[model samples]
Target chain A: MKRLKLFPISRRAKDLLAGKLMLLLTILAALLVLLMVAGLYLKSRPVLASQPLAELLFSTKWRPFRGQFGFFPFIMGTLWVTGVAVLIAVPLCLLTAIYLSEYAPARVREWVKPLIDILAGIPSVVFGVWGMLVVVPFIKDSVAPFFKVFSTGYSILAGGIVLAIMIFPVIIHVALEVFRAVPQEVREASLAVGATRWQTVKHVVLRKALPGVAAAIVLGIARAFGETMAVLMVVGNVAKVPGNVLDPAYPLPALIANNYGEMLSIPLYDSALMLAALILLLVILLFNLLSRAVLARVERSIR
Target chain B: MDRRKVEEGIFRVLMVLATGLILSSLVMILLTVLVKGLPYLSLEMVTQTPRGGYYLGKGGGILNAIIGSLYLAGGATLLAILFSLPVALYLNVYSRPDARFVSVCRLAFDVLNGVPSIVFGAFGFTLMIYFGLRASLLGGIIAIALLILPMLIRAMDEVIRLVPRELMDASYALGATRWETALRVVTRQALPGILTAVLIAFGRGIGDAAAVIFTAGFTDAVPTSLLRPAATLPLAIFFQLGVPVPEVQGRAYASALILTLLILIISVAARRLSRRLTRHVVK
Candidate 1:
């Protein structure tokens, strides 16, 4: 009886300890989030209040020194590059995922999946270096010349292509998981109804996996938007909105990186960079929230 | 029969191309870095410091950057592992069945992982400056810890949850304390998975660039002290890539190659370890 009593008491104490620890971690994580918000607001309040956010949003010029802080060019640059990246990545990712999950032999699937995942684990800086050396040069010497009107190189096309290469793995990984999650019987039933293998994938598998595929595409977009080193290295660091694919332009992160050191030497300039950080953070956060919502929807549909 | 065979052949070609492209990009990038870097790669290049400071063709070895990366990544991994293990265990064993808090914890990790590395860099830069830490290794370590923490939690939590329920039931029936069950039974069962988590987190710490960039000021000196400023391979590449001369730029390519090789080795090790863990689960 005494032994039994001791067992229950100890188990209860252990459970209590676990609960406390979990609570602590949860509180700590929440505090970090709060701290990040507070830090940004603390630094950016003066800039946020003194200047209208709308003008900052719509202004074509990004000269922070002269206080002409329009973010239109940076915003447009990020969207255009990411738009191109997604347009390239999504279809390739989906096709690969469908082929690997539904059509490939089991032995082939085993080998192919890991190779794709390895691409995801490679560092972005490596991609940046590779892009600057190989991809940018290739675009300059070969691809840009194809566009007769564009006389020079090191442009948006180079950056977008490199980014698309980087995010392709992510899209394939996520979409492959989605494709694999589709029940076997669903495919078997479609096939049994005399639908071709292509028809089964295009009509049934894709339809079922659309939400997950959408989530993967959105995640890819968010990743492309926030990427720094690779884009900075390959985008030519030109600080204007591009007129064509060959025109060089800077994104928000690039602006922060290029100007942060010089800005730190000046007083209000640091605050201005903080303003850029604030904007960049908010854009990423909004996209992240949207992706999570889509992911949740996918899960719900699965259940 | 002919039509069916033709369609199948087309699908096969498409699949091959899709998979082929991913591999080709990887090979292309690796070859580019290596070819550009190979001419400058030498024992002297890695062992000595840059003599010309920021100038071309005269800088010594990348020794300082390599050492700094190891020290910072090592320190960050230690801190992150300490923070993650207990938290993961608590998450798995604690909480009422209806508790909303576990879900919130999961949400927190998701949000944390989703935060851009650059934002972490900015936050670290501001906080460290405000707190008088300057651009020190501690600052970099903390920033990296924050970045790795989410991945560790998710990985460990998944492993712990995957521990078979029967093990817990048997241990409890045999009068083992819940703590004993967790430490001896559940954790032992999930050892491979936990090891995979730690390894992956370590690899991530080693490879990460953006989070450490602002916190660890690029210095030329070897980092014997964690508080001293230092450079990393990625930062070296970043700084040197902007060098005006061809020779110096070629050196940046070499440094990038070295860093890329390091990242590839570590990631391959992680993949192998994860594969082993999955195999163990099947057994």
Candidate 2:
């Protein structure tokens, strides 16, 4: 009997040991983000020390061989592409989400959900290939000419259009979830009060889902900001701030990707590129944190 | 009242149009790839490595890239599963539901999931320099593994969290220790979800180009060792498209088609496997 009791204690000890092992692994996994931030910062310190942060961020000069690294144009390029993408994607995705959630039949919703998943699953490189073969030609041949502007088809608009398409599935998926999360009774109550379907969607459903919708948009923007290969392929990598949507502009990711191989040849070039990556990481981190905070608040309020 | 009705009609039409537009674009993308790729895709293109002046529209296939991608992503997935399973299990089983540490870890994973693949590439390159490692298959695996780690863990966590609590209680009632309950009962119950998460991470890893471009330097031959430079299908497409040769460009489309088909198969398999595995599931 005493031996049997000791058996249970030994089993308990084994359980405790297992728990401690898992805890250590979990902590190591969680510390990866901190490791990435610290590594990038330390590598970028040379450029950060040589130039003032404001000058590095705000200056327009970018002579890599001469050791000058102004990132203002790339920053602006990122903003322009992401801004245009958001402007194009949000309305279309929101409308699509509304249709799927409120208007489409259950069968149709089931069919379309998988389609959106397919869209999301399509690789970015494939999208770049399509953008190059189709969107760029269309822009150069039709859209730009119609707008009375000349573009080589590689411009901020091309990047934005491709990016908008890439982000459509992301926004639509999230927005559909948000819309579906609205209690069925809430919709019934509005309808019972003689509210039109559109009215309920515009007023009550939208109101209840406003935070989620905002979170979706923020997520899309974050995606647009950091996309590398597709945008790099389409956005003509001119090292100047784009004056209009049709102008070719270089974004930061492209700068890092295109020049990383050759950066070792030039002084502070690697540092500058690392700093670009650091900035990208910081911005994306901020956007993600903000969206999470917004989501958490809504979840708490709902509870 | 009439104006409101008109407004409703207009918005309804707008919604339908927007949805139609999105659907049409999907169709367009698929058609573009199929139409452009079919003519160039041959059995040889899948069988042989690139020969002399392949970029010049000469005789050769992308077997190197196809094989290399499989190796890189497959190795990375295995590596990620090693870390992801333990972390995910810990988050769902070893901690309290409302534990502060658990929430913080969840939040960290969420943020990490949003970090772009390019950042991983850049960071991996930094590590490579520090460790005096060259761009090789091993480097690519490490980079892609990190890129997919958070995604893998979060996906598994979501699935493991959905396992019925009562099932765990029953395990405990049977005199199973917490570790036994977690490993045997919880994991068995969540097997379908765990498999789905693993496949999703594998798909993401294989499809990703930004994370592997710098870490996996292009090579004509298949990777023979972990330290050798490797080619991937996405980079193959990118490089081939950059060439001004029309035939080379056509091969790029073919490569994209191959990659797309691989992803489609994996996704289909994941759905089918999960559905089949749920036979013993309680609900």
Candidate 3:
């Protein structure tokens, strides 16, 4: 009887210990985010201390040699590519969401949803290869001739188009969910008032879902801003202020990726790259918080 | 009324066209990669390492990269599962779903998911520098695991959430502790979902180029130790594509072909497993 009692007690103790261990592991998962942010900020101090923020933000030069370390061109490059991507992706994604949520037949929706999922799951390197083999050559052969000078097709335009394609499915999926989440009663009320289906969607459903749509767009921005390999491969990796969409330009992710291996040879290069990583982190964090704020408001409305 | 009718028609046509565009693009990319990469996919590519001047479009194969990729991704997947399973189990079994702490933990994972891979590479580089650990299999594994941890945790959490509460109550009524229920009953029910989460994390880790690019230094040999420099398939493709030779370019296509095939197989398996999990669960 004593032995049986001890066995059960011992097993209960083991179970309690297991629960504590899981709590520790969960904390560890959260700590990793804090660790990354702290590491990036703490490590970037040397470069941020030695250089003026004004020069780093405004100057155009990015030559690693001769001690020049301007990041303006890279900042511009990141903005340009991401801006073009947003311009191409937002309208089309919104329309696709409307169609899927409101108009798609059940069978078509089932088939199409998985297709988008497959697209989202595709590896970035495959996209890079596709961009390299198909998009760039097509642009060079067909689009370059119309320009005043010859272009290699490996330009910001190519980068943006590829990024647009990469992020399209992800953003549209969220938007579709948001649209579907509008209360059915609200749609019925609009229809009872003699409103056409299009009118109801435009005035009532979309208006109710606007905040969620905004959140989705911000998330998509956060994604495209720091996208690395696919954009890096097609963007031509030139360090210059892009004169036009067809001009080759350097972006921040590409800059860090390309020069990372050789950073040891240059003064403050590692620190500079660390600073770049810090900026990317903070900016993405800001966008994330904005979307979270909007999403919270949405939850409040639902309640 | 006429103007509104015209507007509605135009919007309808445009939306349909957008859907068609995505479908055609997916088809176009798959066909393009397959057409260019199929002829070069041979057993030689899987059986031999690159010889001298391999980057210059010479003879030999990419066996080292295949093995090295498997090591880095495989190691990362194992490490991520260690952390992810505990967090997921804690959320679904030990705590209530609507608990404030649970939502906060979920938020942390969401933000971590948004943090870019390049930034993870930067973080790993910092850690390596501070510890005096040069690029190695271990360093790369840690970086990729961190990069995929949030994704792994979230996927597993969704699966765990689907585990019915009645089962836990039943186990408790049977004198089973919370941990016993979680380990035996809860985990048993979530096995397929857990496996699918593993597949997703593995796929994410193996295909990532930016995150592991710095932490895993390049080599032409298979990784034999945790402390040695390792190569990966994405880096292999990147290096070959840079060689400016048509022959080497073809090899890049072949490497990409292998990588894409691995990803496709994993994705198909994951979908299948998730479907099975839904049907076979709690029956």
TM-score of chain A of 1: 0.90
Model 3 agreement with the true structure over A73-166: per-residue lDDT tens digits: 9999999999888888898888888988887889998998878877777778888999999888877888888665678989888898889888
DockQ of every candidate: 0.51, 0.77, 0.73
Alpha-carbon runs more than 4 Å astray in model 2: A1-7
Q: Using TM-score, give the best candidate's number.
A: 2
Q: Roughly what TM-score does model 1 have, to 2 decimal places?
A: 0.93
> Highest lDDT: which candidate?
2
lDDT of 1 by residue, A1-303 (tens): 899889878777876776677568657864676678689768877667767889877788766667666778888888777777787777677768877888789998888877776677777788888887777777778877776655345778777888898888878877887787778899999999998888788789899888888878877887888787788778877778778777787877777777756776655666766777777777767776777777766666666
> lDDT score, residue B176, model 1?
80
How do all the candidates rank in terms of TM-score, highest first? 2, 3, 1
Which segments of model 3 are wrong by more than 4 Å? Answer: B277-279
lDDT of 3: 0.87
* Worst window of 10 by summed lDDT in candidate 3 chain A: A294-303
Query: Candidate 2, after superposition: displacement of residue B232 in Å?
Result: 0.7
lDDT pick, better of 1 and 2: 2
**Which run of 10 residues does model 1 chain B get worst, by summed lDDT?**
B90-99
- lDDT of each candidate versus the true structure: 0.78, 0.92, 0.87
In model 2, what are the clashing residue pairs, if there are any?
A: none
Quality of model 1 by C-alpha lDDT: 0.78
